[model samples]
Target: MEILDPQNTVLTNAEVYNIVVEKKKAFSSAPKDHRASPALRTVIYETLTYLSGSPAATQTEEQIKSLIRALSPYKFTGAEILQLINLRPKTAVEVQLVIEECEERLTEEQVNEIVEIVKQNFPIQSETKNSLEAAEG
Candidate 1:
């Protein structure tokens, strides 16, 4: 059997501990209620899993929160905002209006980056696929 590189494996306990400590420090210094909204929390959790290249099931709520805190400066709330924009638009004008509204707070580049992250972390599934189609319809 070939020898595997240790660096290619998962983080060691010490590394994990250090990360947690740093995360706590960052989180403590952040503005209160940065992630107080349920919608914001959901977006933060999803973004953390994507950015870490880790399975969502393996992450604890605290870990998720920590990662969110670390990325606080990004200011955008990941997939949740995308989901909102995807909601049914009664007319083309309405869709255009919504896009215009979103453009004020989020740049197209940021939105595109979030889309790419989602594509990498959560491959589209039948249920998700159908829901998105339904939302558009």
Candidate 2:
């Protein structure tokens, strides 16, 4: 697993939750025989939770990765790893680079349009905003 910079990423807890939910849906869609194994299901759920930024209870990343690798026996190719890493939050610089790389696949106009839409809708709201405003009064 790649170590992502804590500062550059803009992923909130909600995004992580959504990712976990998507993974759960995928896991559920697998064949019943594969899903029936309690040990396998546990490993799958735990691994997805950990990847989604949940604090690990006991296992280190290596240990969890090992368990998942052993239980699932599905090897991720380099391309797959790269795709997952791309889904992770990135620093401003990294985001720029990614945008550049994907510019051909997506037009500059499209990128700017999407950025504008996000900026319009997702105003930064601090967790303590409500309490702080109330206290000020």
Candidate 3:
């Protein structure tokens, strides 16, 4: 994919999940003469579970990519976009905190755009909603 960003980057948790799955497939299909490291495979599986959460049931990698595209105009880096996916920030203040390290400051409108995309793709459960509202209030 021709992402208008630096190399060696991922745009979302789903992309990371995809990488882990591909690695598992590669290790399993390796020639008998070429044994894969069990330790490394274990790490990949752990990371996948950590990054995926339960959102994998609803959001696909392509949907994550579409979210990234929607947010591209805000000029966030791929790493920042991935963080947005993982964090699923629902408010402008929350989104701002997540992207606080960015060199470019986003306007309130830009932040809202990101918040909208995240909410549309990764709807939070009622428990999470209550917690977020309590924290924000």
What TM-score fits each model?
0.26, 0.27, 0.60
TM-score of 2: 0.27
Model 2 has an lDDT value of 0.43
lDDT, candidate 3, 13-115, per-residue tens: 5555666677778877889667567788679778877754545424566777777788878777766777787777878877877896542687677777778
Q: Going through the candidates in order, what is the number of backbone clashes in each?
A: 0, 0, 0
- The C-alpha stretches of model 3 lying farther than 4 A from their native spots are 1-7, 54-58, 101-110, 123-137
After the best TM-score superposition of candidate 2, give how far the Cα of residue 1 lies from its true spot, in angstroms: 28
Return whichever of 1 and 3 wins on lDDT.
3
Residue-wise C-alpha lDDT for candidate 2, range 15-133, written one tens digit per residue:
45454466578778888765536875686577666644432222234433443343232243444323323232123333235443544444555545433432333332342344546
Q: Which candidate is the best by TM-score?
A: 3
Q: Identify the candidate with maximal lDDT.
A: 3
- Candidate 1, residues 26-67, lDDT tens digits: the string is 765779865245664565555555534423323334543444
Each candidate's lDDT (Cα)?
0.44, 0.43, 0.69
Which whole-number lDDT from 0 to 100 does residue 127 have in model 3? Answer: 54
By TM-score, rank the candidates, best first. 3, 2, 1
